[model samples]
Target: MKLFYSPFHTFVHKVLVTAHECGHWERLTRVATFPFKNNQGEDCGDTYDISAINPLDKVPTLVTDTGQPVFGSQAICEYLDATSRARRMYPAPGPKRWDALSRLSLCDTIFESTVQMVMEQWKPQDQWNMGLFTWLWPKFNAGLDSLERGAERGWDDFDVGHASMLHAISYLGFRAEFYEAKDPVYPHYNWREGRPALAAWFDTAIQRPSVASHYNQPFTSDSSAEACQAAVRECIALRAAHGQ
Candidate 1:
């Protein structure tokens, strides 16, 4: 199996991390593709002819040995879980499976909103649209709040579903301080507290060789300060374009 992905993407990272945790990394060939690039010239593309296989040109598209194509992180993850005989990532069919599916759906929704937010800020200021942010931020917060409430119910024994949510939340923190700042007021503010089981689980997952490998240096060799400045400039330019 060939797993084609762009390391710069958090969604792709999530899938890769899960695959690694499920013990399928060894049987898989990692194909690095560039789907997102920065001003500094980081390029991402697809390995297979995307148009022929996937109607939508996207990264993280997996091609099985039988010439089957699977797209989307969630779908690909499900495929990985189904094709592997190792311990199942998702629970067997029943309430547990539904529960996991629901959480996975939530992860997809929140991640989609987050990506839109990033794109909204990537454009020139004159082309920016505050309305988009206005519309999405509240939805994003609502999703986070929902996750917080779910976490409060005890995600320590997080099945595959809950694990995906945790990864999404942590990825937001790792990528954006804005979300981190808002986490204090989030519904389950102390979700990580008194949850040694979950904490240990996350600790182990994050440090796994596959997961750790995803933390490769940023696409750009620019200094941290420079990156921040560039991001700020982009945001400001975007806002200015939108007259926000």
Candidate 2:
């Protein structure tokens, strides 16, 4: 199986945690892709493009050993859980399942919206979308608060929602610490501030073997665009060979 994704390991990736927890980590061949770089401009070339395998040409795309492509973090995570060789991240259908899914939805939104803010900040400061930051900050505040409440109540075990929470919070921290642009509303934003329960939960969660395996760890293998395209071609050939 090939897992084509962004090489950035500055934050925990929910798909990676799911794969590791589900015992598919060793079975996967990680492929570094930079779809956003490709989108910057056509003159920059499409060397990183994986549109041949994935229509959206996005990262976090997983090609199964049988050559079936699964995109979207949530879909890929669910697939991993369904075929889990070890443990399942998703709970069986029940209230626990619904709650986990709900939290997953919430944190994934935070992660995606935070990505949007990062992209918007990439533009000239004058061109930065103040309105976007204004609109999103309140949602971010509310979302973290919701997570805090959940953390305070606690869970019996680590689940998909916990993985997503790691993904969202880690990236949120990364943006504030690494990105140069200052948010208009909360220039010195600190997610940890006043969210003691969430912070404690995050500290403990990061130590989990699944999250520890990739979080904050540098990608050591070949991460070039050429390598990414090669992996994409391999998946295409595999699918063709199987007449899929």
Candidate 3:
């Protein structure tokens, strides 16, 4: 199997981590792609033809040995668990599978919301929509709070559901800190700090070679102070233009 991915993307990291846990990481060939560029002219790392593999032009697109294409991290992981000799990451088709799917959906929601928040802040002032952030952030926090409560109730095991959740939490900690810092009132903003089990899970997840590779590469730093300052200026300019 050939795994086409951008090393700088958290979504790609999620897929790689799952493959590692499933013991299929070494069996796969890593195809690098240029998903992000730094200040220099050189591509950061991981070059691929996203459009060729998947029309979505997204990272973490997996190509099976039979030439089947599996896009999306969740779908790729599901495919791996289904076809591999490794222990099923997801349970058999039954109540357990349904539960795992639901949790995975929750994790996807959190990831999507985080991406939305980042785009809203970083996009040009004319393209910005403060209303979207105002509306979505509260719901995002509510979802995070629910996940926190679930973890508190002892759902932090390595089941398919919590594996996705662990990936989400670790991704947020690494990539979405700017958004979280901007909105500290988020319900589960500090959830990981006190949740030792979840924290440990995240710790282990981030240490995998796949995850470490992503962090070790150079990419545009959206969470940097300069980026935050630029976002703030853009927001203020937008507000002023609207006579707010």
Candidate 4:
């Protein structure tokens, strides 16, 4: 299988965690893809494009051994869980499943909204959308509060929801540290403030083998577009051979 995704290890990736938890990490061929470079017109040319397999040309796209393409992160993670050789990230249908899915939905929204905020900050201060920040800040606060409550309640085992929470929370910190400009609404925002339970849960969760596998680690594999394209071609051939 081939996974085309942005090689940003500063933040946790739920897909990577799910892959490791499902025991499919070693079997995956990681292809570093930066879809943002294309949007930024960063002179990367067409090297990072994977639109052939994925119409959206988004990252975290997985091409299975049978050459089937899975795009959305949730879909890819669930795919990994469904085909697990080790532990499962999803629980069977029940109240536990519903709670896990609810958390997953909430955390994923936070992660995407945070990405939107990051993108808006890419513009000059004068051009930044204050309304976007205003609209989103309250949502973020409420969402984090919800997560804190959930964390206080805790769970019996690590699930897809916890992986997503790590993904969202780590990126929240990364945005603060990585950018030079401060967020207008929460310049020195600290998510851990008054959210001790959530912070505690995060601290312990990061130690899991799934999270530790790629968190804070540098991408040492081939990151060139040529390598990524080569893998894409291989998948295309596989698809043709399988008549898919």
**Per-candidate local distance difference test:** 0.59, 0.89, 0.61, 0.90
lDDT by residue for model 3 (1-244), tens? 7666655554335576677667786787665554343222445332233464568756667766656668888899888877766666787788777877888888877776777667666766567676776787677557666765665565534556666676666666655445555542352456465466556555665565645655445554343334423433443455456555
Leading candidate by lDDT: 4
Residue 9 displacement (Å), model 3: 7.2
Task: Give the TM-score of each candidate.
Answer: 0.67, 0.96, 0.69, 0.96
Ordering by lDDT: 4, 2, 3, 1
Error of 2 at 33 (Å): 0.5
Clash count, candidate 2: 0
**TM-score of candidate 4 relative to the true fold:** 0.96
Per-candidate total of colliding backbone pairs: 7, 0, 6, 0
Off by over 4 Å in 1: 9-12, 37-49, 177-210, 216-244
Candidate 2, 1-244: lDDT as tens digits:
8999986788999999999999998998899888877856667587788988889888889999889999999999999999999998988899999999998999999999999998888899899878998898899899999888988998888999989999999998888776734777877888999999999999998999898898888899998877887898899999998899
Which scores higher on lDDT, 1 or 2? 2
Residues 6-103 of candidate 4 have per-residue lDDT tens digits of 98999999999999999998999899998877645556778788998999989889999999999999999989999999999999999999988988
Candidate 1 local accuracy as lDDT?
A: 0.59
Residue pairs clashing, model 4:
none
Q: Mark the 10 consecutive residues where model 2 has the least summed lDDT.
A: 176-185
| lDDT (C-alpha) at residue 160 in model 1 | 64
Model 1 weakest 10-residue run by lDDT:
39-48
